[model samples]
Target: MLLNLAIKNFAIVSFVEIDWQQGMTTITGETGAGKSIAIDALSLCLGSRALANTVRPGCAKAELTATFDSSNISKATKWLAKHDLQQDDECIIRRIISIEGRSKAYINGSPVPLAQLKELGQLLINIHGQHDHQLLMKSQEQRRLLDEYADHQELLSSLKFYQSKWRKLNNELTLLQQNSQQRQAQLQLLQYQVKELDQFALQDNEFTQLETDYKRNSNAQQLLLLSQQCIEQLSESNNITEQSSALTQLQKSSEQLSQLAELDSAAAAIASLVNEARIQLEEASKDLNDYQQSIDIDPQKFALIEERYSFAIQLARKHKVAPEELVSFHSNIKKQLNAIANDDSRLDVINDELEQCFSQYLEIANSLHKSRTTAAQQLEQQITNSMRQLNMPDAVFKLAITEKQLNEPANHGIDEIEFLVSMNPGQPVEALAKVASGGELSRISLAIQVILAERIVTPTLIFDEVDVGISGPTAAKVGQQLHKLGHSTQVICVTHLPQVASKGHQQLFVAKLTDGKHTQTKVTELNQPGREREIARLLAGDEVTDSSLANARELLAS
Candidate 1:
């Protein structure tokens, strides 16, 4: 339920604070006295669109704040908790509109998007404007009202979920069908590429090993000549040269030092060093001879290695990669080929899944259709009964449920609902917009609201002059229904009828005050005498007479 409303610098309302209560509160004023200004301010707090003109002429901005007690409203409390904006059981919604046509919204002191404010606002209050009945003309709004009256949120949610899933799967199937030829062409190209790489037969680390073998074999004769020359120089040789071989010279030097060692210790050390050098030369010569024997000069093996190395280079350049990268590149192409081969199977699987999703969607849609059909019948009867109580004895209300073609699925299911009415005894029932007059529309709108009020969970309901085209006993019936609604929830009504104003448990009078240069609107909560005078004024216009006061008292007493 709404606890309070604070508005400042909004339109001609410089400042107004209203402490609302848990029953019907009527607002009354003279014509052009800004009686609806408070409702307008409350609308801003409910996230309605704001304009720069909403700000007072001399003020920089307009501010509105509304406080609600949501301790018993689970939907509102859950929404606050879900958004992490909960402040115990009190929900404060504030809106600020700047003169530049910009606006900001806050919930529980945390800044939020305007959409969040609107979403949370719906759970807290339902406002029925004087012209809300005009919305009954639209088919979509008709469907929504019927669905809301049906109270089958679970079924609606299921239908929407399956519809979403079906749409996604259907889109995938469409794309796959459109791209079938392109996928086939891609698959062929991948197949040929994979075949070429497979024939190359490159192995990991084989490229480097092949290069080493080729280099060693290509220089076989040169290696043999160099090895033989080194061996001949290190040992004794028959070559006719003036220089003795290194091994022969070292042996001769060792013999001369050994003879001198008997007379000198230093000569003995030198002889020992010469002998070690001779031994090292002999070992080096033996190893060189062994290497020379191991060298092969086979042309067949050399030609094979050269051919393999050239082919590796050519294949690497063809693939736009180094020879060492060929193995990894071959592996990647194989994987792509395998994936392309699987697309046809994937298409079949998607088609099967799409069918399953559509089946599920149809199941839920059929259930929802049945529920709506039943609800339409029940609501038609209830609203028809309510119309009689609102003084429309001959008015007939009907809900037309037309089923669309099954192939054309909609988020709201297959039923197209519309409200039809007959206002006279001999008149055929026709669309509400085409048949009902403005006064009839007001009563119809009120009847629907009063009937739906029992099922709607919103804590507060505000009627903005909904009794505009109603009067007499019909106006009293409207007032009585509103008062009855207030028994279950909070109701604030802006009205111009004495019958309605006299029924309010509390009353507020909106008065315009001016000093010739400036005008402002003030809302004052009325006590017993004040209410009597206001209701008397509503009954008798600007002049309050004894007869009007007596009528006002009798109306209040009743």
Candidate 2:
């Protein structure tokens, strides 16, 4: 339910804030007193397209803010989560329009695209406007309305699944049939590619190991020379490397150590280290020889390696991939080979699946059709009954459903449905939104929303001037229905009738005045006597009489 609305710098209105009612709220003013300016503010929050002209003259921007009471926001919360939008217990939707015609929408402090705002707004509130009447003239919209009343979403899902399967099968069959008389060369190439890939027998992560081995073997000679050179320098017999280095130096020092035994006992340990260094040099030399001998540098082996590398490179180039992608390339070729070789069998399998899907779809669709027909009939009967309550005693509503060739998902089936109405007996029923008067259409729209609100989980409904043309007892019935609708879903109706206004659990009055140079709009709640006076004003004209006050008081007290 809309809790409050605030507008600033809108056309003919400088600023206005309205605390709305949960049930049958009414906005009453003399016809041109800017009732529409208030509606325009709500429209902005509803994501209606804005124009620079709507901005007040000399104002840089126009702004609108709406707060919704959200004690039960499960549906809205789930949708917010789905769209990655912020979720809160309250709905604070705001819109800003610049004088240059740019607009922005925000929800719970998060910026949102106008389209998202519009989509989410529909779930929160539905505005019945002149264009909504045009929806009746369109056969497609009529079908959708009936389907919505039927609540047949699951059946539609099954039907769509079947249609998808049929299309897939048809596409496969057509492709194979078109290529059947030829394609032998393509098939042979695929098979050959698959066979070659199998011969290589590629394994995951093996490429890294092969590259490492290749690099090690390619530098084996250099590495062996370096290692052997180190060993030779360590083992040189005549230079410092022999006499001053390692073993030769140690031998000279050990002979001197015995002459100076008291001061040179530590020389033995140094000599031992030199001996170990000589052993290390010997082992290093042997290891180097082993490594050098192990490297396979035969011309035949080199040629084989070169041939394998060239093949890998050429294949990689053909596929526009690196040699390391060989595994993926092999898998792709294998898949293509399977598709080609098993084309006939796969086609048969798909055809069987298509037939099965079609049979299942038809069976369930027929059941769904029967259920929808029953539901539509019941819905039509209920709306027809509601018309009598709204003071149209001889009215009837009809649900018209026809078989249609479908290409996509529908809430129901491949059947087009329409809502037709006749205000009098023995008259042809026309589309509801078309033939009904402004007031009658409002009632019809209200009835449908109220009835469906019991089924659909939408949390809020807004009726914009649905009480425009109705008065007397019929207006009272309409207000009662709205009251009932509000019990289940949050409802806010902009009404002008005292019967309707009096039914509100709350009431707000929209008043406009020009303070010399600028026009301003202000909205405020009416206390008991004040509400009665407002309703009296609606009951009578510009003048409020005692009799009108009595009538207003009676309506409110009742």
Candidate 3:
């Protein structure tokens, strides 16, 4: 429900604030007295398109703010949470239109895009203009109305779910059918490639181990000669026998120096360093001997390692990957081959799934169609009875529901719904768009809205002069319908009829104010006496006669 509306620098408004309440509220004024201007301000705050000229003269911008009580508006609260906007039970929508034709919109103090503002606005309020009756003439709108009345949201959701599955299956089938020949050729190529790769018997880390073996095999002769040289230098040789070896010489020198250390302490320190060097030399000689013994100097192994390493390099170049990555590459190729070889089986499975999806979609759509048919019949009957009460005694309203041959599955099901009306007896019923007069359309629109009031999700409904071209008992009937609708939700109606105005729980009067230099629009909430005088003016035109006041009082009392 809308809590308050604030307008500033907006088209003769200057500044005005309205605290709205739940139930029916009416705004009335003479023609061109800015009643519609106030409605326009409310519309702008609710994300309507704006113009630069909407800014009052000498003002930089036109600003509007509408506050809504969102304690029960779960859809809007969820939307705010989803968009990460400010979250509160009080939702505020503000719009600013500048003199340069630029517009900015905000929701709950968070700046929002105009599109988002419009989307959120839809959940908060619905405004029906005097021209909105023409919307009833469209087939799509009529279908929507019937669907809303039928309350078939769950069935509609199931239809969408099945339709999506059907589309996915069909897409897969189309791709396979359109490229069957190409896929067959690809299958043969993949099989041959897999066969070639299978011969290599590639293993994880095989390339790395092979490279290591190749390096060892290629340097075997050089390795052996170096090991032999180190052995001769560290141990015995022809020129350096047991005593002449470096290890032997260091140990003998250290023993002699230690004996002299008893006479000098500095000599003892030099002897300890010589002993450590001799120990290291002995360990190196043992390791060199072990390495020489471990060397494998086989010509056949060298040849085999060289051949395997070259094969790996050539294959790596061919596959456009490093030799180390060949294992993963081989696995990927095998997967492709497997998929191609199993294409016929996969295609059969998809065909079965597609058939199943279509069957399910048909089932759900047929059920939805039945519900809509039932709803259309009841809706047509109700509207016909309502139109009669609105002064169309001979009016006949019908909803035509026909099954159309769908080229492809549609989410909305198979029924094509249209509204047909006849204003007089013995006249052929024609489409509402072609046959219904403006007055008849307004009544029909009012009837539909009143019938669907409880079904609509919008918290506030604004009727901007929907009572146009209606008066007397018929106008009273419209007022009574609006009053009935207000009992369930908030409603604001702009009107000139006294019968309609008198039905409001609260009344506001818009009038032009002049200070000789400029004219501005002012809105005043009328007390009981003020309401009586205003309604008397509405009944008596330019003069408030005694008889009009009496009638206004009686109308208010009733």
Candidate 4:
């Protein structure tokens, strides 16, 4: 239950704190005395959008806070626990809006987003009023309320899981059907690439060897000719034996120098030079003979090297890669070919998987549809009994379920269910919101809310002059219904009828007070005696005559 509400800088309610009780509480005041300010503040605390103008004049910001006792709100407690914002026994929700258009929301002292506040707010309060868009009037809202009462969330969850799976499979099938030609074109390209790679017939290290051999053999003739000249100069001459002739001349010079060595030291030095020159010439002749034997320029082998070099370049250009990538190209093409060849088998497996998913989804959806059909009948009977007690005895009510065609996954079923009604006995049944008179609708809504309070988690309900067009027995019935509903939930109502106010467990009176140029709105909680006096004033205006006071006291006693 909502225990307290505090408002600061909110319209004419500069600062106000209201402590409330669990059962019915009614607020009464003269017109335009700022009674609606309390409702507006409650709305903001429950996550309604706020305007900068809602702040009192001369104030930069407005603040509203509501404290709720969540001992009985299990789901709300769990939600708060998950978010680390649980306040052991009570939850405080606060909203602050600045004149510069900045807004902030908080739950249990933890900052939260406005959207989160809005989502959690519905769990604590519901307000029903005249000239108000009540939730029961809308088909979707009606369905949700019934689902909440019946605890059909698990069934709805299953249905949603199915819908998501069905959509995914449907999307995949469409994509594959539309892109089959594209896949075929890709397969053809892959096949052609594989054939091109096979024809190249590349070998590892073949290009390196071919180029090396070409470079060596390109200068083979020049090397051979150079070696022949060296051989002649050293040891291979036919007419002139070059190395042998040089050796013989050196020996002759050495022998003559040796004969003169005993007579002169300079002749001995000349003999040593001739011996060294003959030894170096002999080694040079041997090296030249080795070079002539090793050079080979075979025409067939040279032709093969040239052709292989040209082929390496051609392969590189055709495949658009360096010579080293020839081996890699072969591996890539083979992999693509394997994928294309096995594609049909893989596609069959995918199709089978999607079929299984689709079947699972349909099965879940059908189960949920059946549960809703059964629950609707039970819910119709319950609401009918409630409305009869709210002074609409002759009214006829029906739960009309029509198959919805929008293809959405509804928790109830693949159908739209409306709360249809006929206010008069002879009239044909029509939509409840359209056919019921204002007063009848008020009573009916109260009855439905009373039934919902047990199932819904919200702790507070606000009725804004819902008994506006009612009086006498009808007004008394509205009071009785509120009294009954209040036993289980806290109800805040703005009312003009003493019949309703007298039945409330608590009463607050809104009045205008003037000080100099300032006009302020004040709300005060009244004790039993004060409440009777206030009701007397409501009945007989400012006079509060003897009969009116006596009647007000009688109402309190009753």
Model 2 score (lDDT): 0.74
lDDT of 3 by residue, 1-558 (tens): 999999999988889999998999999998989887868888788778887579999999988998988889888888888898756689989999999889999988988999998888888888889888888878888888899999989999999998888888788888888878998898888777778778977789999999999988789899999999888767766763344766667778888988888788889888888888888888989988998998998899889888888998888899899999988899998998777767767787997887778888888989999999898888899999888877889999999899987656787889998899999899988899899888889999988887787666668889999988888998888888888788889999999999999999989999999899887899989999999999999999989999999999988887
Off by over 4 Å in 2: 6-15, 36-69, 72-126, 156-186, 196-276, 288-332, 335-346, 404-411, 428-443, 446-460, 468-491, 496-506, 527-558
Give the per-residue lDDT of model 2 (tens digit) for 251-349: 565566545655777666766665566567567657766765676656666556556666776777876888898888888878877777788577668
What overall lDDT, based on C-alpha atoms, would model 1 receive against the true structure? Answer: 0.88
Which candidate's lDDT is highest? 1
- List where candidate 1 sits over 4 angstroms from the true fold: 30-33, 100-103, 201-339, 516-518
Expressed as tens digits, the lDDT of each residue in 224-319 for candidate 4 is: 888787766554446653345454566676788778887898778777777677678778778777777877889898898888788877878887
**Residue 449, model 4: Cα distance from true site in angstroms:** 1.0
Q: On residues 381-443, what C-alpha lDDT tens digit does candidate 1 reach at each position? A: 999999998899999999998877776346999888889999899999999999988888888
Of candidate 3, the 10-residue stretch with the lowest lDDT total is 237-246
- Report clash pairs, candidate 2: 240-245
TM-score of each: 0.79, 0.70, 0.84, 0.71
Candidate 3 clash pair list: none
